[model samples]
Target: MRTLTTRAKVAWAVITVVVLVWALLPVVSIIATSFKLPSQLNLGTFWPKTWTTTNYEQIFAGSAKDLFLPALRNSIGISLIATFVAVVLATLAAYAIARLDFRGKKLILTTALGVSIFPVISIVTPLFNLWRNIGLYDTWLGLIIPYLSLTLPISIWTLAAFFRQIPWELEQAAQVDGATSWQAFRKAIVPLAAPGVFTTALIAFFIAWNDFVYGISLTSTSAARPVPAALAFFTGASQFEEPTGAISAAAVVVTIPVVILVLLFQRQIVSGLTQGAVKG
Candidate 1:
């Protein structure tokens, strides 16, 4: 590699600093506001002289009826269940698409891709009616099914791409050793596809977690609503009276788990994304 000139190096450093600050500004602001007292927030300062965790305390103490903890629990439960179901279903479907030769295989793949691209709003009304008729409305199962609909297509496509990267020779050797196709898939293919599966699960989890429209539209009771929808309760009709500090504090708390998960699995995400791109 050619060495950079002093001027170029200086310019590169400035650009990097600018990009870093741009990326982190919102996060920094959220954190700063989380610690500020309610009175000091609208003053618009980078740092607050008086800091308090009273907002967080009220939330944890269960004093705030509109607090996010219950919503957080609901979000976590729905996201985990949805991700699990989506991953399993997608994995099996991807295996068949990738490894089996059958009529309409191309059509199946195309349909899955088509489903992935379709606007979610188009299906919401019908899905809501269906759930209501089936007596599944406002239930975890109801949410899980819709969440799966949102996540499944992408999960199938991503896993199918990753599955194509696996060497067929391994499966062939396992077959020669008297292993059935299902056994070979379980023993060999699944192990090799762990990273891709993990990435798909995480993506699906985040999608389910972040969804506000469907959660709010489909679920009427606070018991079933997730964090994103629950956060909307913090807003008032009048802008001037909104609890910006409490809202920001709740947001900070809500975002922490996701941040921790992403940081923990950063390597797996990078590996899986690159593997899918290069191999597929």
Candidate 2:
């Protein structure tokens, strides 16, 4: 294999650094803004002249607490439920697609791809009306169902690809030993598919968590409104007080969990997306 020359390596390093800065600059700015006192927001500085936790307090315990807290709970509950359901359903469907030599397998995969790429905006209006008529509006189930639309297709695709890479012989061996089909899948296939399932679960969770379009259109009251949607309801204490700092603080609060999840599972995510099970 040809090794990278010193000059080429240096060039690659520079490009990497530049890309990192470009990607992280906005996030850093948001974090800094979250710590800034509202009074210093328009001071023409990249960071606050004097930092304070007043904004954080506003969201956690002060005026915005009622809105932020409930929304936060709704977001966590809805996203987790969506991820679990999507992963479970996707795992079963993908296994069938990969393991069975049935007709319409290609059609199933293609339909999932199409739904995953479909424009979400086009469907929101219809969903809004249908949800209201069907009495799903402003409810957790309402949001979870829409979230499945956003998460399920990609999940099916990801797990299907991963399942195809898994050797079927392991499952056969288990069955040969008198294990039932479910037993073979649960004991043999599931253990090997863990990394991929975990990665897909994370992806589904993130999709549901960050969704603003569905969250905004489907819900109204804080009873079911998620953080992404509740942010739109944020108001200043008075005409003079700006809500920028509070909004930034809330953004940071919601973002931390996602960052932590990525940090904890970075290895599994890379493994799932980039590698398949080793074949003998």
Candidate 3:
């Protein structure tokens, strides 16, 4: 690798710092606000003069728990279920799309592309009425089903791209060595595709977890409302008080799982995304 000149290195460092600040500003602001006292909320600075954990305390040990905890559980359950279903279905469909030859394959892919890009707001109204008619409104299943529409197309696309890079010869070679079809697939093909599947699951989970419009528009109660929507309804100490600190605290709390998830699986995510980028 060639070394960068001093001027080029300086320019790159400045760009990196700018990008990092731009990306992390909101998160940092949320974290900083979460630790601020209610009186210091509008201090017009990043850090608080008198830090307090009252917002977190309220969320965890007070009445807010009734709303926050249930919503947290709903978010976790819904996102996990959506991710599992989306990843499984996407894997099968991706394998077929990448390896099989069939009529209208391009059409199916094009349809998926269209559906994925379709504005979700346009359907919320019709889906709201349809879900109420079908008895699925205000239910976890209601959210999970809609989340699939958002997640499936991207999952299919990503997994299909990654699947194309895998060598089918490995599966055939395993079969020739007396392995059964299932065994060969599980032991040979799956290992190669696991990173892609994992990456897809992460993507699906994030999509489901961060969903706000559906979480709010589809559910009226905490019974099915997720953390994102629940946070919107958080009440402050009094009617006149702003829930900014509580909102920030809740935001920080919800973000922890995502941070942990990325920290744990970042290597797999990077490998999956870059799997087909370089050929040697």
| TM-score result, candidate 1 | 0.87
- Candidate 2, 1-280: lDDT as tens digits: 8899999999999999999999789988999999888888988798888989999999999999999999999999999999999999999998899889899998988888788888999989999999999999999999999899888987888888788878889989999999999999899988888877888898778888999999999999998999999999999878788789999999999998888998899887666545422221
Where is model 1 poorest over a 10-residue stretch in terms of lDDT? 58-67
Between candidates 2 and 3, the TM-score winner: 3
Model 2: per-residue Cα lDDT at residue 105: 93
Query: What are the models' TM-scores?
Result: 0.87, 0.90, 0.92
Best by lDDT: 2
**Candidate 1 residue-pair clash tally:** 0
Give one digit per residue, the lDDT tens place, for model 1 in 1-280.
9999999999999999999899778988888887887667778798776888966765666345454777778888998999999999999988898889888878877787787678878878898899899988887787888887778877887788888878878877898899999998778866888878889888778788888768887787767888788777775224765567667777898788888988899887666656544455
> How should the candidates be ordered by TM-score, best one leading?
3, 2, 1
Clashing pairs in model 1, backbone N/Cα/C closer than 3 A: none
> For model 3, how does the per-residue alpha-carbon lDDT over 164-255 read when each residue is reduced to its tens digit?
88898999999999999999999999898887888888877888888998999999988899999999899888898998888888999999
Report the CA-based lDDT of candidate 1 relative to the real structure.
0.79
lDDT, residue 77, model 2: 98
Q: What is the C-alpha lDDT of each candidate?
A: 0.79, 0.89, 0.87
> Could you tally the backbone clashes for each prediction?
0, 0, 0
Alpha carbon lDDT at 1, candidate 1: 100
